[model samples]
Target chain A: MPMLDLISSTGVAPNDVEPALFDAAVNQDIDALHLPNDADLSDYLDALPRVKSIFVDFPAFTDGRGFSLARLLRHRHGYEGLLVADGQLIPDQFAFALQCGFDAVRVKRSERERHTAEAWQAALDAFDVTYQRGYAVKAGPATSIFDARLTAAEANKTTDPFSA
Target chain B: MYRYDEFDAEFVNARVAQFRDQVERRLDGRLSEAEFRPLRLMNGLYLQLHAYMLRVAVPYGTLRSEQLRMLAHLADKYDKGYGHVTTRQNMQFNWPVLGDVPDMLADLASVEMHAIQTSGNCIRNVTCDPYAGAAADEIEDPRPLAELLRQWSMLHPEFSFLPRKFKIAVTGAPTHDRAMVRAHDIGIEVVRGPSGEVGYHIIVGGGLGRTPIIGETLRAFCPKDELLPYLDATMRVYNRFGRRDNKYKARIKILVRETGIEEFRFLVDEEFKALDASDIMVSQAERDRIAAYFAPPEYASDIKALDLEAQPEAFRKWVETNVHTHVQPGYAIVNISLKDPERAPGDITAEQMRAVADLADKHSFGEIRTTHQQNMVLAHVRQDELRAVWDGLVAAQLEDANINLIGDIICCPGMDFCALATARSIPVAQKIAERFNDHARQQAIGEMQIKISGCINACGHHHVGHIGILGLEKAGVEFYQVTLGGDATQTARVGDRTGKGLSEAELIDGIERIVDRYMDVREGNERFLDTYQRLGAETFKEALYADA
Candidate 1:
């Protein structure tokens, strides 16, 4: 009954005694907020400034509501904290989990028996090019193939005046 | 037709390697059936009743001659020598072994095709009007936009594990909705704004499985660059809020129905406003680059003559049924009838496929298009070479001469193949076609669509047929239900159910009786659906159960 977070390429354990401080969280005594997979984020949008970390649950891996939850927390609410994916997710979903803005993941001990952190990292490195825009790239600023094409087009325009 | 650039080519090749690795893991003990099921389905491999079925995406229903020949090669080598064209503008090989799928995929990748997302709970293969570029009524070809969406949704992270499968359809023509955009999850229509700005009219939450619902307009007009972001917002809303408690009620249509379209629109708008699309929007250069691949094929402009006077009556009938007007002069879009009475609708043999591929290279511009009605189209055939194409089709036994006629039925791979089917569909379609196979009699019936689904899942799109048939199992015996007056045109509607279910023999008789009823009380040149609408379903209901 442990959470498997694949967000960190080099896995991270759950912060012990962290999620149980809801009362303290209400009083601005804590910086983390743990939410169920279906937690309504509208009520917490006002509290995002106080909260530094959001741990979204994936009750089951088949329930993908958490992916959108993480996306909304990051892109919409502008939450730049440790967005942790905590649940039963496989290594195959590592790339997607990262693209959705999860900085760390907690995997179940059972799943870790066969799939190690290295396997998850390998899975993350499988795709060389993705058509999405929001992932934290291995190197420079986050950009899709379209952005790269735009940059190249601009470079060509500068070099070859007649290209336009 | 859109040609694959280096990016697309490399993307598909990488996917082939990935699928090969996944298959190897499955064959070993690394992945369980429960774990491997979704992965296999994402790659369009389904374990059906008989064997593994692989559905290959025909992106926007456009295929080059080499791609068709590759499909034929795969069918002959790895399948049972035939392929079935699906309603989603895909080709399904129903007999591929699990081990051979990766090799088959590699072969498809060589021809710039893949089975990715074709049968998964994700954004599926984007379908468009089969007559997109050639149709005279089109404002602009929707294939560029469709291609853009295809790339955007491929392996999309947050939206990949949707509650149910998502389908998007696009159409450029205002009047001729061959893509059935109104009945899709997200139907897009290309439109020109007041000042001549090209944009998209977006519709959301329409689907036709067990519950058939027409999509409501979400955005009247969104700028071209805003298409992907708008879609990202809508998908985020659906993924976050769609019901997962029940599998049947999990489609976006159900969500839109349960939570009103107004609320859904508000949620999407809020998300759209929040998401920063500064770097995500499709750049003009990228759009132009993609559009360039779809430039008009070189066509003979001076050839305006067609010698139909010397042709036989059968060939003339074929021209009348299968030929459609093109936007360009001296060119016609030819509809190849896959609904030959001798074979199942949409099922093409390997030899027939090769023949069609050769015909495509010779008559058309080495391109073929698959329609939602489970037929193939040569979208750029010249009028002068129409006779040669007709002759080639005749040699392959594909000259059915019944494009929109009674014999042209759309049927699903029912209990015979599909694991989800409750009763058989192909036999019933074959029987009905046999009863109404007369060429002259079929012409007399006029333009009618008889769509049959083995179960209420409605893969055959029976919900929108002029004469819809749904097969069910009652007391361990097969029974059929008849529905009337459905249309998938600009005016989309779900068919109304008639009397109780009938047996196989009685079902055929019932349809004949219904046709007889239409013949007796008919107006000139009125379609079967129009006739049924003029005289209500109640009249047909009475006529059907008069002797019951």
Candidate 2:
């Protein structure tokens, strides 16, 4: 398979693939156009009109900015595009990807495939659904002034005179 | 003690679960260490030089007896059977595995506790006085405001990530216990205005790093009600204008320095007007509710101190060394020194946690505090119970009786854990404390505080120590520099560096030389600081290097 490596922000995939290439065959892009490990959510928020599955870079796991980008693209912007993590993308991110809305992962051919696949499946198997707002996180009753005012508004039929 | 409501309970439980899931993925190799790192970090986990360290927040340095016991449980179960109290009033476990952390966090959550936001670039734990409610000199208890900030910043959408870490300290008393008005990213100190109304004196940009700055005064007087919004303004100005180009220069302290305090204040004031000040942010009812939670519990007005017909000389020494006056007339603030003579400074075992909790519940109110100097405090014990409390504490091997003395040293975990540290600090602190263990000799030496930092980040509160010792690596050899007559008291000042750094062998000898000089020159048994003030640094500096 010929890889379209993206080397920089201004660069694009080496091969001229049609938008149809996403489902037809697996194509890889390199560091061109400076896509992140987590695909650019803001860019993805715009129409991908041409590319479908693009490989993003993780750089490293500690670089959570990429992970966060993936989350925004999948959960908030609601991008259904196929996302494959490239570069320093570790299998650990695969589960977080699944949570963030990634389907498959890309790794070196020399990588342990079976274990990686098992871990990815385990991550998916772990959680059931998207949280309205992360059901798993502990909720604080009194969070914001707005939250308090809203709660107050709900409690008293009398209108809150001091609404923020 | 403020018990966690359902909301508090739920928040911590879910947070624990999230971190647990993240940890499992890391161990299973599903998540790369890079991807797994921030998740752990946001949850207060850090992979340092030796192993993973989890810094659990003892909010505003306040913890209930049961909450503290849980910390002890984690110490026994997952760590090296001990935890180190940090300068920020948090506890850091040196050895924790990536796998057992979720369970550790779960244990923490069961007691309405957490390790959340203890680190990372987000709002770190809010710090207040170790003696919050009962301190004699306080204008008001600072815990409620600390809690307010905790809620306002928790998982805050915009500030979950910022240019750099933010630190804020608060104090209610006339005497600064929290170092509140220092050069914090933001510092809050209570002051009485001409109207005799107690209002916050806001300070900004005071911090220690590559650039050490004392916070510049932003507001001489701000009403208590406007605090959150006022803080919102300060943060907004920082968020909009703070330097994002350099992480080191990103603290508010740098911004204030460059813009100048007057200009910075002008910018913050402008932002304050634009912030969400509508009833949504802080309403009367909301304030009342929060205030209700923090309302002082009524005490038995006539409660008398017990008759201590016998006061052990040891108890007297401990009292002389450790205890302080509380705001509550009959109560005393007991400082429990964690710096043992032979052991590492700030290392407290799980059993010790239970012991401290027992002391809190039995002798004092059910509250304990962790100080910025990495010591513990039993905040409101009746003076009458001092002997009994001392006896119980002594048995736990906790009554080091070295508070504020030369032996009560503040030392950081240097090369042992902090990858940033250039030299070992614990050994140096331990060595100094051991030298000063002779009570009479220590009295002769006089009131002195020794603070040590492995590196220059000043996490050990070294800058403000009366005898500040900064450990630096000189040609791969650990070298120590001593600073004379600094203080972290109500009126805090950074110490002046005396001269050249000393070698490890010569470090203790250097301290001894300085002390011996003070003893010789002293007109009385006043502190080293008083004598230094009376005689000046030239005499002490000359004495330190006289043998050299």
Candidate 3:
């Protein structure tokens, strides 16, 4: 298995730390935590300070609960530790995962062979811009298209004519 | 009517290129069918029972003449020679080959139209009142807000892959909800604050399927600037806590029902307070810019009303049913009925599409709107020029005086084309239309909505029909269930089940008996839904099951 660093847009070796389940990690003295998509974030708030890395399971790429979990962990709980997405996800989801506060994705060896590293890198550069804000993109924070348009209008100080 | 600026055009073109690459990947075996299904669905290409179905979004049900012509071109060149208007105010081509969908999307993009987010688990196309700007009772035009939401929700990163599909509808009129706002996941009503500033009243968790629930008000009023953040917070909450174990219970309605609206609002408020929405909010200038596109067209002040006495009796009847009063003084809003009894409801031929485009160009400032009732509206026609418009429609075989009559049915492409359907809905709709083919009788029935869906998914919106019909497969045989008193207006409610299901042989007769019973028990000038509300479902149930 390999880990794809979406922020750096490169494939790297996976970390050797074995993450324990939420119960085990909280009860024992483990520093790494593994959470399911449906795991309650409030339950782990106390244990998050000591946790070094949190691995959120994406049972399938289409299952998007992991993205929300990543957002909650990053924005709501202020978890500054390494958050890794572990399971089956396509190259198309790499950009979304990166924007949703994921640090890296643990890809299965077979899945990597099928999709290839270059495909993942290309998927990252597929869209140069986005429509929503409050996301951590490679270029600092994401600026919404609406804000960009308003900035352009301010710089020009003139209205653009409507053309259909 | 909002035009794409450079950014919008570039984004749509880029998406078309991405889809083109994905299609190539699928064709060359780089992607499996399972992996390719969601990607294709996000771009609005569905593999149906017969062939591929491509749903092209008509954003907020508004279109330019050139856009409509481009749709006709796609129908002629890539698909079967016609298209189907869906219940959500989008267009669906029934028989397009899988290989040609990318080219079709490219064509759509050329005319500022694309099918992005028309399907998949993303926020589907944002719909609004078809008469948004032209309605006489509109407090504000809803299209600008609908357009803003459309752009905001397009290819959204965090909310794209939700538990299930999401829908949003908006209405500008306080008294009438032609947009069917309460039947969506998030229903927004344009409202005025005490200081005369415009805000939105947000309703969340309304939906129809196997389980139908009318949405409850999530926020009494959301300030215009905070709308995006509020919606973002709502989506975040639903994406995080909405049920995923059961596919059937994955909608936001189920989450709202399970968590209750009060708790859901609390969670949303917590999320909303944390969101930094300065960059996401629409500026007043930007809103004004969008609103300018929907401004009323210049009307001819010298235009005079048509003389009804000189026109034929048929034309007078058509005027009575199809023409609605426009806010502009000398202009009228005309509905072009797609429900000719000989054809399936909402199906329009390529030639008819071109004719509509021509009519729009000549009479309605080149603007057209697709209604949620599966009809097209020429939003601005001069009173004197209506006869000319009617002549063109008659020539195109599109002049069916059945705007809100019983003949104007809303039906989904059921077993004939859809893979998920249990029985055929189009033929059933056509048979009912034929049974009541008499124009005078249909007019006498008066403003009746008979919605039919082939399965529990309720694509036909059977749950909101005045007379609802749901078709199910029982022991490999098709049976239909009738529901009564569903309303889709401001006072929206899900229809109640009458009793047991009826066979195909007994369905039409049963419906006729119900209508006959309503006629027998009705007071002066009351519609079918009004009569049903006054008498209740018990009366209709007795009429339906007495012989059995």
Candidate 4:
């Protein structure tokens, strides 16, 4: 597995701290926790204080439950610690994973070989603009098309005071 | 009718470039078919039974004359010779080489149109009442809202890959559900608040595939500005909790069904509460900007009402069947039927497309609308010019005068083109149309919807048809099952299945018998659905199975 930090746009060496499964993490003093897509965050609320890293399993790239889980952890339950997307994911999903609050993606060795690291980096700049706001990327909060339009409108207003 | 501004233009061009690159990658073996399928589908390309099918999104079913001309060009250049207007109010070119799709999309981009989100698990093209601005009883034009949602939902990173494809429909008229709102994943009805401020009544989880369910009311009144946040919240809930174990149980409807509407509402509200409304709230300025494009076109003040009394018998009948009342004085909405009994329903030739574009420019303020019933509408046609428009349509052979008659059918491209179809559907629809081909008989049967689907996917919306036909393969033989009393209006209901499947030979006769039985048992002035509602499905079942 190779870890790519989308926020930094750089590849990082895989960490030696293996994520403990839900059952083991519940019983043991594990700093890194691994949860399935269907893992209820409420059940893990007690363990959140001790866990420094959380790995959400995607199972398959098409199954998007992990994206929501990551968002729920960051925005809803306010889990600010490291969140890693683990399992089958393609380069096209790197930017979306980042937007959904995943700090890094741990890609399978096979997928990494198929889709080079350059491909993953290029995918980040695939679309310069997005239509959504509030979602975070490595840069900062996503700037929506509406936000850009509003800015342009404001700049025009300031430049031409007489124009309504 | 909303024209793309610089931002929209840039976004679509960028998307086209991305898709082109993806296609090149797939062709050169950098991307495998397993990985390329979802990507291509997101761009509205599908590998059908024949060649690739490219569905171009006609956002809110509104198109300009120039856009229609572009579609005509695409049909002539890329397809065999025609395009099919689907039940979702999108246009599908059934024959396009995989290599040529990128170029086809680039052509569409020139006309401010793209096929993005027309397919795939992402939110599909938002459909709306074709008669939005013209309908007499409309509360407000739903196109602005639809356009806003379209922009917000496109390329939405978080909700792009969901458990299954999501569909949304909007209806402005309180009296009619012309968009088939209640049969979609999220149905929106424009409503006036207590003080007459426009808002939306949101319905969640209504769909018509394997399991037919009318959406339950999720929100009584979602303020106009809060729509995106609310929808974002709903999508988040569905994406997170919707089942992924089985593809069949993956739609939001199943999630809503399993988790009770009450709990689902709680979850969505929780997600909505976490969202920052200002991040995505549609501003008043942006709202007005979109709405300005949809403002009613100027009309002739001195236009006189149409006097059909002295018109030819055929023209008068066409007006009686195809004309709909418009809000503007001396204006009418003209429905151009694509159902000719000779051609597949919704299939229109490129020549006819150009003719429609020309006619639209001359008679309908250069605007055309595609309907859920696979028909085209000239939304703002002056009553005085309708005769000329009718004449033009007749010249083009696009004038079928079967707006809601038995001849008007909504059918999917079944086994002839769709790879997913278990049996043929278009031939059955053609047979039914031919059997009742008489103008007087069709008019007498009156306001019947015969929707046919090749498989249980219900792309033809057979679940909501008045006389629904579902074609299936039983023991390697084609079998047709009929359902009765389905409605797609404000009071949406799934049709009840009648006993026994009929062979292709017996299907038309069974339908004819059902119609004959309805004629026998119906009260005066009642439509087929009204009669069915009064008499129940058992009566129709008896009629269908009597000879068997």
Best by lDDT: 4
The two-chain DockQ for each candidate, comma-separated, is 0.59, 0.07, 0.53, 0.59
lDDT of 1 at A134: 61
lDDT of 1 by residue, A49-160 (tens): 7776677888777778999888878877788777788877777787777778787777776777667766676566567667776653552213466666677678766866
Per-residue alpha-carbon lDDT of candidate 1 for residues B397-507, written as tens digits (9 for 90 to 100) = 999999989888999999989999999999999998999989999888889899999999999899999999999997899999988888888799989999699888888
Q: What is the C-alpha RMSD of each candidate to the true structure, in Å?
A: 3.0, 8.0, 3.4, 2.9
Proportion of native contacts in model 3? 0.56
Cα misplacement distance, residue B460 of candidate 1 (Å)? 0.7
Q: Could you give the interface RMSD of each candidate, to one decimal?
A: 1.5, 8.2, 1.6, 1.4
Report the C-alpha lDDT of model 3 over B285-389, residue by residue, as the tens digit. Answer: 888988888887888899987898999998889999999999999899999999999998999999999999999999999999999999999999999999999
Model 3: per-residue Cα lDDT over A1-164, one tens digit each: 22574323243224322334345544454444678898877777887777777778899888998998898898778999888887888888888888888887877777876688877776776776677655638732254567678888786866557632
Q: Which CAPRI category fits model 3?
A: medium
Model 4: pairs clashing at backbone N, Cα or C within 3 Å:
none
Report fnat for all candidates as fractions from 0 to 1: 0.60, 0.03, 0.56, 0.57
Task: State the lDDT of candidate 4 residue by residue for B1-548, as single tens digits.
Answer: 79888888888998898899888878888788988999999999999886899999999999999999999999999988899999999999998999999999999999999999999999999999999999999999999999998998988878888999999999998688899888999999999998988899999999999999999999999898888889989998999889888989999999999999999999999889987676567789988988999998998877877788978999998999999999998899999999999999999999999999999999999999999999999999989889999999999998788998999999999999999999999999999889999999988888999999999999999999999999999788999999998999999999999978999878888899999999999999999899888878888898898889
**Candidate 3 error regions (>4 Å):** A1-31, A46-51, A139-143, A158-164
Instruction: Give the least accurate 10-residue stretch of model 2 chain B, judged by summed lDDT.
Output: B274-283
lDDT of 2 by residue, B111-189 (tens): 8888878887777888888888877778887777778777666655335545578888888875655544584687888
- Tens-digit per-residue lDDT, A1-164, candidate 2: 11212234333456534333433333344122235442324433344434455555655433334444544454445555565555554443444444334445555544545235555444444332221122111211113334534475567666668965
Ranking by lDDT: 4, 3, 1, 2
